[model samples]
Target: MAEPSLKRLQYFIALAEHGKFQLAADAVNISQPALSAELKRLEDFVGKPLFHRSPVTKLTAAGEALLPYAKSAVGAAHRFNEYAAAVNTGAPTSISIGTVATFLHRGLPQTITDFSAAHPDILVTTEEATSAAQSDMLLGHDIDIACGHMPLQHPGVICTPAARESFWLCAPTGSPITTIAEAVDSPFVIFRKSASPIYHDTVVGICRTHGFEPQIHHRTASWSAAVEMVAHGLGVSLVPSPVARNYHGDERLIFTRIGTRPNAPQAWITVRREDQSTLIGDLALGLVIASEALADPVAD
Candidate 1:
C-alpha cells in the first residue's frame, strides 16, 4: 500500500461528506473530472471501493472505516500548517472580529477564547453586526473578519464558509406541534429583520418550503429573545442548531430537528480581498472549528 497525498485524502473526505462528485468538487474548488479521477486514485491506493456512486452517494463499509482517520489526519495537518505560519510571521498585538448576533451568542465567543489562549499577548475584540454591515466594516478595515450567514456579495470581499448550521424547531412545551407543518398555523417568531435579516429570511424561507408562508407574528431584537418568545407560547421559531443547543435550560422550551429539515444554512467569514495573510487564516480556522463544533444535529 502507498501513502496517499493529503490532497487526495482531503478529496476523499469531501466526496464522502458532500455525496456527489460535482458538489464535492465545487466545495473543494476542483473540476468534477479531476475530483472523480482523484477519488478513483485514492480507492486504488487503498485497494477498496469507497463510495457507492449514485444520484445520492453513500459510503461503502471501507469508506466508513476510513472517515474518522481521514478527518483526524486533515485536522492535524491544518494545525501543523497554522503553527508553521505563526512561527514564520510577525504576531500582531490585536485582532478584531465582527459577527451577526446569533454567532456572537453561541460560536464566536468560544472561538475568541481559544484563539486568545493560543496567543495570549494579542488583544481580541468582537462586535455584533448585521450581515450587510459586517461586509461594510470589513471593507473599511474596521474589523479583520466578518462572520455572518451567506450570500455575502462584495467583489472586494472574499467569503469563506465557516460552517453549515441546521435549523432546529423551537416551540413551547405542550404545544400540539411535532412537525413544522403542524405549527404552520401557529405564529412564528424570528429575529427582527433590521437586526438580523439573514435569520429572519432563513425562518421565513423554511416555512415557505414546507408549503405555507410563516405567519410571523413576532420579531425579537435578539436570538435569545426569539427563543424566549417561543418558550412563552407566543409562537414557534426555527433557529440554528447553536441557539437551539445553548438556550434549552427553560423546561417550557422544546428544541428538536425540523421535521421537514430545511437545507442547512452556511455561516461565512468575509475579509477584504487585499488583506490576505496568515493571521486572517488563523482567525478563520479557529472560527470554522468552533462553528462546526456547534453543527451537530439536535437529538429528538
Candidate 2:
C-alpha cells in the first residue's frame, strides 16, 4: 500500500479529536461523505478499523494505537510545510494580525497601511477579536500577530511590550468628573464581561472599592456605539486613553483623568517567539514603534 497522504492523516487527526464524522467534517471544512470515505481509505491502508461507531464513537484498538502517531504526523507535516515555505520563499505572502476593536480607530489602520506600503509583496490582514480570543488565535496559528493590553502567557507564544496607555474617563465635553464617585453617577457605558475581563473587572472593582457600584446603562463591544451613546448623554465610560485620543476634537465627547487608576495596562504585541519569518517580525516591530509615539496621559 502507498504511504498515506497528508490530507488523509489530517482528517484522521481531526476525526479522532472530534469523535464524530459530521462534526469532524465541519471542522475540516469538507463534506461528511468525503471525510467518511477518506477515513475508510486510511483504515483500509492500515488494515484495521480505526473507529467503532456506536451511540458514542469509539476508537478501535488499531485506532487507539494510531491516534498519537496521527497527531504527531499532522503536526510534523505542518512544521515541514512551514520550514519548506521559509526555505522556498514562494510561500503565501501574507500576515494575519489580530486586535480588539478599540485599537482599530487609531493604532491598527496606520500601522497596517505603513507596513503594506513598505512590503507591498506581502498581504496584511487585520482581524478584530476579543482579548481572550487573540491569545487562542496566536496559539492555533490562526493569526500571525496580536496587539492588545493583556499579557501573552500562553506556552509557545512570546509577548513583547509594545506600549503603555493610561486609562481615562469618557464623557460629554466639559462634563465634571472630579472622582470615581461623580463618574459612577453618570450613565456608564461599559465593555461586556467578555470583551476584556481584566479591564472590565478593574473598572468595576475600582468603582466598588470607591463605595458604589456603577450604574451601567449600556454594554457593548463597539466603541463607536459607546461613544455615540455617550454623546447623546447616555453614559460615561472608562477606556484606554489611546482610544479616547482617537475621539479628540469631537464636540460631543469629553475625556477626563481617572483619579483611582493612574497607570495604564501595558499594550503588547504577541507572536510566536520562535517565528523566524522576516515579514512577521517587521510588522511586530512597526506596532511597537507606533505605540511608543502615542503614550501621553491626560493632564490632571
Candidate 3:
C-alpha cells in the first residue's frame, strides 16, 4: 500500500473547514481540478468516499473519522516546519501577544516598534483578541503573552499589573451631556454583549444602579464601527479611556467621565509558563516599564 500523503491530509482538512471544493482549492493555492483529483486519489487509497457532496458540503462518516487525525497531522507538520526554520535560518526570536483594539491606537504600536528596534533579531506578532480569547490563547500556547483586561482565573498563568484603563461616555461633538442621567438616557451603541464578561456585567449593573437601563440602539463587534456609530449620532457609547484619547480631539466626537465613583476595570498582562523564552521575559519587563510611565504618581 502507498504511504498517505501529508498534502492530501491538509487538503482534506481545508475542505472540511471551508465546506467548498473550489474555495478550499483557492485557500490551499491549488486549482480546483488539482484539488478534486487529489481528493479522488485519497478516496481511492482508502477505498471510501470521504465527503458527501451537495449544494452545501456534508462530511461522510469516513470524513468525520479522519478529521481529527488530519488536524493533528497538519499541526505536527507546521510545528516541524517552524522548528526547522528557527533552527536553520536563525529566525528572530518571536513572541505572540494579544491586546484589545483600544491599545491598537495608544501604546501597542510604539511598544512593538521600540521592541523591534532594540532587538532586531526578535519577531513580534500582535493579535487583537477579546479578554476571554486572550486567556484561551495563553493557555493553549498560541500566544506567548496577552495584554488585556484581567481574564478569568486559570491555574498556570501569571498576570502582571499592566495598566489601569478607564471608560468614558462618548457622544457626537457639541452634543450636551451635562448630566450623568442624561448620558444614561441617550440611545446607546454598545459593544457586543459577549466582548468581555466582566465589562458587560458591569455596564448592566451600573445602569441598574443608576435606576435606568440604557436604550441600546445598536450593537457592534468592531471598535471603529462603534465609534463611527457614535460620531454619526446613531447612539452614544461607553468606550475605553485609551480609545477616548484617540477621539479626544475629534471634531465629531465628545467624551465625558463615567461618574467618579465608578471606573472601568484594569488591564493585565498574562503569561503562560514563564520559562518559555528570554525574549518573552524582556518583552514582559518592557511592558512593566511602560505601564509604570502611565501610572499615576504616588508619593512614597
Each model's TM-score, in the order given?
Answer: 0.63, 0.71, 0.66
| CA lDDT of every candidate | 0.76, 0.75, 0.73
Question: For residues 177-239, could you state the per-residue lDDT of candidate 1 as single tens digits?
Answer: 878878879888887887766667778888888889988888887777888788888989888
Total colliding residue pairs, candidate 1: 0
lDDT of 2 by residue, 1-300 (tens): 888998998898788779888889999999999998999999999999998888787788998777756665565456568758856986546788898766664367899998888888778898988777787667656677888758878556678776555667788766776455787567788877776666667678767877889898899765777778888877788777667778888888778766544344546788776663567877888777877777664453
Cα-based RMSD of the predictions, in order? 14.8, 5.8, 6.0
Ten consecutive residues with minimal summed lDDT in candidate 3?
291-300
The candidate maximizing lDDT is 1
Highest TM-score scorer: 2
Query: Could you tell which candidate, 1 or 2, scores higher by TM-score?
Result: 2
Clash counts per candidate, in order, are: 0, 2, 0
**Candidate 2 local lDDT, residue 17:** 78
